[model samples]
Target: MDRVVLSFGDSLLRSSDVSLLDPPRWLNDNVIGFAFEFLAASLSPPLSERVAFLSPEVSQFTKCCRDEAAAFLEPLALPCKDLILLPVNDNSGPEAGGSHWSLLAYVRRPPGFLHYDSAPGTNAHHARLMARNLSALLEGDGGFREERAPAQHNGYDCGMYVVCVAEALCEQHLRGCDDLILQSITPQYVTRKRAEWKDVIGELSRKSAVAPQP
Candidate 1:
């Protein structure tokens, strides 16, 4: 997940004018809340204006109480013109194994929320729960939709899918397209991105080592 975020940030810098000077470099499954928060913070103007990201902590809090959750999210909602990416994790306990990652994207053109799950149907209930809370918080008429996104072939790649989907959506938004459907993200793409990330991280490490310490 850490490598993926760094790779995505580098991609953004290369493809566009977005500047991510100190992007998040390390994110593990246990600290996904921080991962989402870091993603939200890393976004720069124009792209940042097109999309907003809610932290996993907000999603977790919504599972407890919708009212309180609405209050909590009310202030964090960004004035995004296009979409809001909300990461959701539905796991009860440590004994229950690893948590699953999914996305709840609220798009503005058609004015509806779409849930993208790599494990399709696994997080439907959680998506609906979040939709309700977001509706109340945003004060929009409830119009939630579910689209089975490109599924992950492995257990650990859900976070990768989330980042990839967000990247695709941002690209689409930049092109002024409302068809928010994710086309496809193949294993080859993931493999290439992993290699690219390794190179990016290696360069960053070398640069840090050469810099004089104050």
Candidate 2:
């Protein structure tokens, strides 16, 4: 049986999930969702109230249909958010049904969805579909624009690119950057960022173990 290795907010990573951090292994939804949770928790006031980091399940679920989108997303109160970060997958499902992963973020500043796909155009359709769903909720009309992102040299690194680019964007926003039009992603940068995941998760786990529950 798989044991839980880390739990942060509503996200949980199993023992097997840690193996996905190994070289050439694709990062599954759990890790991405956990990263989103951690990032949201670390944001300061104002930004914290304006930004939202959605989980893979919530993002995927809204893709079903319009009625479902309204019923599901309305409760989340996404319209009031200035920025929303979502990890996109080629296939629409809560499970690891997609063969590829990408990052789709919506910024209310200029009012457009930004897609960062390491596999280039691999997950564009998925990004557009979900972006449309979010768009209708936010402003009733808009389209996704592909942002420059690091291209993965290998198939499995696409997932890491999503995490890395998402981190880069959030880092920029935290540092007082106004727009998501920044680009610093490179193969070497991904390497340095990806190398930190194991230690990051370990530290998070250690902290969770000692924290007082609500």
Candidate 3:
């Protein structure tokens, strides 16, 4: 499963000059950040503009002082838009502690923030902290709400679940679906998505080989 995600990331890096740095194998415990970059790059313009994929370092900084965190985010000049997908990690050391992923999605037509967590109880505090930080970053506009997304059935699939939610939300936004409900992305669905991504990676690799290089 990890290899599948990494291969997808490799394809994205080859296809575009994304902001995410090449992930080191030593950081094998997590590849969710790279996966999010791939998803963000896959989206079309404007919709893609609305999403901000934060590095694990930046996401981790939000857990500390609010003013400092806001300063870190403000310099990025992120688009204040309909949705911001954030991947969260509970621990600092790469191999030391457990990690979970979540999203801070903003719905503009209704004007509110929705914190969607795949593993609900485990990361509630992390999600709220992120919401508060985001609210502060957005200059005191608060109305952060929590919505229980489809829960993961096992321990290791949280990263994949994050990718699933991001994809579903992007589709919903593109189709103009109000409420932005996450689809029924079961574990079986994730397995299938992995297979699909494998094929995508192969196709992209072939295209990259033939395309003229700058």
Candidate 2 deviant stretches above 4 angstroms: 92-95, 178-182, 210-214
- Cα lDDT of candidate 1 equals 0.59
Give one digit per residue, the lDDT tens place, for model 1 in 59-143. 6566546768766766665434477777766754322123577788887776788888989988888778877777776646349
Winner of 1 and 3 under TM-score: 3
lDDT of 3 by residue, 67-127 (tens): 7877778876553666666666666443324556566565554656677677776777776
Candidate 3 ranges with C-alpha deviation above 4 Å: 1-30, 92-97, 178-181, 201-214
Superposition error at 159 for model 3 (Å): 1.0
Quote the positional error of residue 189 for candidate 3 in Å: 0.7
Question: Order the candidates by lDDT, highest first — what do you get?
Answer: 2, 3, 1
Candidates' TM-scores? 0.69, 0.88, 0.71
lDDT of each: 0.59, 0.77, 0.60
Compose the digit string of candidate 2's lDDT tens values, residues 119-160. Answer: 888888888888877777887445679987778888788877
Q: State which candidate has the highest lDDT.
A: 2
Q: What is the TM-score (0 to 1) of candidate 1?
A: 0.69
